[model samples]
Target: MELDLLKEAFDRVAKKQKQSSSKTLDIVNQIEKEIEQAITKIQTTSNHTSVLTELKDKLNELAPMNQLDSNQKDINLALAKYTKLLEKCFQPDISRAYRNVDTDPHVLNEIISTHFYRQGLFDLGDCFTNEAREPNAASLKLPFVEMYQILESMRERDLEPALAWAAKNRGPLTQNGSTLELKLHQLQFVEILKKGNRDEALKYARTHLARFAATHKGSIQKLMACLLWAGRLDQSPYTEFTAQAQWEELAHELARQFCGLLGQSYESPLEVAISAGVQGLPTLLKLSTVMAGKKEEWQNMKQLPVALDLGREFQFHSVFVCPVLREPASEENPPMLLPCGHVLSKQSIVKLSKSSTRPFKCPYCPSEATISQCRQLHF
Candidate 1:
């Protein structure tokens, strides 16, 4: 476009110099005539003008970088447009969210995480056993398996005694145990960490840690996650472990976060034990897996220090790790979750409609958290 315009301007200048003095006035008249003819031709054009339009667009797009103000505006505009495109392309896919539960014998968190892990929507796959393998993923147990599932459910609820009984009764996995239990029940004794009470979870963890120590590496990771969840860096041995037990890297972070959680959570070791030990571990495993797999999600998980701290606050309060979306509007009150990804008081749930906001912002995520994000991930 500039090239064409320059050529036209040069022609006009050259023609002006050659014109006679009398014709110099005609030069103005001639230029005016040409400009009028150009405007008329533009108004009369009916055929497709794609080539001219595209050329003009290309020139406009090639704005000079020396115009710093314009350059910044264009960059900002491009970023906003790109972000909108990403949100449109990657909105969460909940269609298959619960599709596998009927057959998989897994927690709801797992279903959501595994399906969306690749897309960075959620992550249950990252929840590793002390062995560093995905926990009870395929439900491959037999015989005492049914008992294990009950134990898992009880553990998910932080029911220490119930979980312990299942662990002790079923005994260790190496003692020639049978493997005919249904899918959910097949989760092994390591699920002890899936309990809410660290004391209860430890009961099972110590037993499994000792019994399965030789064969299963996951026992240690389970123990560590439980210990971390229990808020017991000072007490429980939280070894650094992950897919391969990188204790050195994880220990300092664990200790630092433990102090933070202890200061903020406001709960007892027993309370922390139960939440992080049993209910919380499973939730963490699932939630972290989902968060870690995503490109920018890990920071969001980091920002959720308050959520970790809240577990400490609920001493004597039973911490429930469930995978369902509903908070189970009990007989006493309806369901409600707080802005920080925790549950609201029953009174709050009952009066939520009267509250000022609709679809509130979860202090946890960049966007408003759905009830789905708050779903508990039971053992």
Candidate 2:
């Protein structure tokens, strides 16, 4: 409903702007025509007074300046109405005290520097580190610098650096089950074949792609068929191998593999976390408003009041929910598993145990277990 109101207001503003432009353009064209006629009359006629009087009469009839003024008024009125609608639809800020997740300023600065380095902004990262007196920034920048250089080369269709990196990290890449090296060689082979170098492409494939034949036999067979078409690979049965988009895809895969080998993620963790938080902020702000009257109840909440369904992409780890309390388990209230395989929060265990003296019944099962038998589970 709010989006509809916003869209309606936006449409009104856009319509008003277009109308104002059209009206101004029409008036300006009319004024120009009138001025041109007045100039022509002055140039041709000996009676300047009569020509000037006729020009003044034409100007009065056109009323171009008045038309512009009326258009401006319409535009301003539309803008004012749109602005009023925006103000009505806007949600006020939900002010709340910060709780949970204490972060060190130094560690945060390091993370920011690492993010900048990962983005190929060495100068900016260096400046930030120097200004903040961050040590070990150079160590963090080195690996990313090499990765960016290889990525840039890949963007230009050069695969030498990436091939060399692959060769150096062959053991780890193979261990991780990454087909990046084979994919890079396949791209190179296709590039050669596209240039009508069939024999050269075959030799290149034998030297590089042949190694992966045992694992990727089907892929190798497809590439081998591309040899028949040679320069006409685009029209061949294996047209997917000749696509320009494959190079882009391979470059991204190489970057992912390179980062993975270096014990890093392709995207910065800080970036992912912030993106997920921003996506959930609207829901959080709405919850804050609804729970405004219950200050103490929510202010002390270790977990979120409502579950933010951020989809699978943002779900990086497992989260246990205590069935008894109907809340997500946090560090302060961790999930404890009984011998019978039922999980409940530590607080719930305490409540059901009757102060540790009696046995507690598992919510999901009929089995009873003492508090001492329950073990904490980690995500």
Candidate 3:
């Protein structure tokens, strides 16, 4: 709805601008034509005084100044209206939303440099780190560099580099429930099959893919079925197996698994932070406006007054809300694991135990435990 309003305003401004331009152009052209005709008459005829008087009369009759003033007035009115509409719709002043907080410059520089490196912008990362006097930040680029190299190889349908990396990290990849290695082998087997080499495709599959048969029986069966349409998989019932999306998805999966093994997130941390900030900015701005006079309270707040829906991607951890108190757990009142395997806020446990002087029955079970038996849990 807001976009529609903006578009409507923009269209009005554009229409007015075009109309004003056309009108001004017509008036200028008319004036120029009159002046040219007057000059020609003056040059041909010896009556220069008469031509001058006639030209002066023609110029006054055209009234170029009046027409231009009218056009300018209309343009100014439209511009002023458009400017006000923009200001009203955008609420451009964001100064009131800002809150001053101290941040470590070194950490911020590192994050910026790391973001560049993770994006495969090694030169830019190096330049930034050098300019920031943190040359050690360049060390972060090596891992991402190798990741991109493998991705480049995969883009060329050569999965040797990726397969090697996957094999080297097989243990960790298995722990993380990743089948990147098997998927790479499947892509390779399909490539060989596309060459109309049934024997070689079967050989490759048996050598690399047979081990995954026990766990991935269904996928192995599909690969085996693809042998019937060797060199013509595109015409086969499993046509989707040859789609570009397969390679793209595999690349994404490989990058995800690679980042996981590096103890990093699949998405860039800087990108996630910026995206979350953008999502929550409007709420923060409104809250800042409402708390204008209570700036101290706003600044001291550990959590936002309202929940920001940053979506699933930004949700990195679980938020345990205590059922007994009907409030979320915080550092001051963290969730505690009771002996009965039920969880409750520390405050709720203290209240239930009567200040730790007595035992209390579990809120959800028949078992009882003292506050001492409840352990602090960190999520």
What lDDT score belongs to each candidate, Candidate 1 first?
0.40, 0.85, 0.89
lDDT at 33, model 3: 91
Tens-place lDDT digits, model 3, residues 1-379: 8778778878887898899889989988988998899999988999999998998998899898998888888878877877888888775876655567899998899999989989999999999999999977888889999999999999998999999999999999998888899999999999999899999999999899999999999999999999999999999999988999999999999998888898888888899888888787888887887887565557677666777798887778999989998789999999999988999999999888886759899979999999888899998
Clashes in candidate 2: how many? 0
Candidate 2 lDDT, 80-161, residue by residue in tens: 9888887777654534433456888888888999999988899999999999898776579998899999989988989999
Misplaced by over 4 Å in model 2 are 45-65, 92-149, 261-264, 268-274, 295-297, 322-339, 344-363, 368-379
Please give the TM-score that candidate 2 achieves against the real structure.
Answer: 0.76
In terms of lDDT, the poorest run of 10 residues in model 3 is 293-302
Q: For candidate 1, lDDT tens digit of each residue in 1-379? A: 6446555555544543444333445545554555565556667775436545644564455433334444345455555555555455433433321212245434543343333332222223344321244455433222124333443454353334333443453533214342211111213322333343557656655644554456556645555464455533333444232212232222223223323322322222433444454444434445545655664344333233224343544455454322232243444544445546565434443243344444545433555544433333221
Give RMSD to native, each candidate.
28.8, 4.6, 5.1
TM-score of each candidate structure, all chains considered together: 0.16, 0.76, 0.76
User: Where does model 1 exceed 4 Å of error?
Assistant: 1-204, 231-379
Using alpha carbons, what is the TM-score of model 3?
0.76
Q: How many Å off is the CA of 166 in candidate 3?
A: 1.2
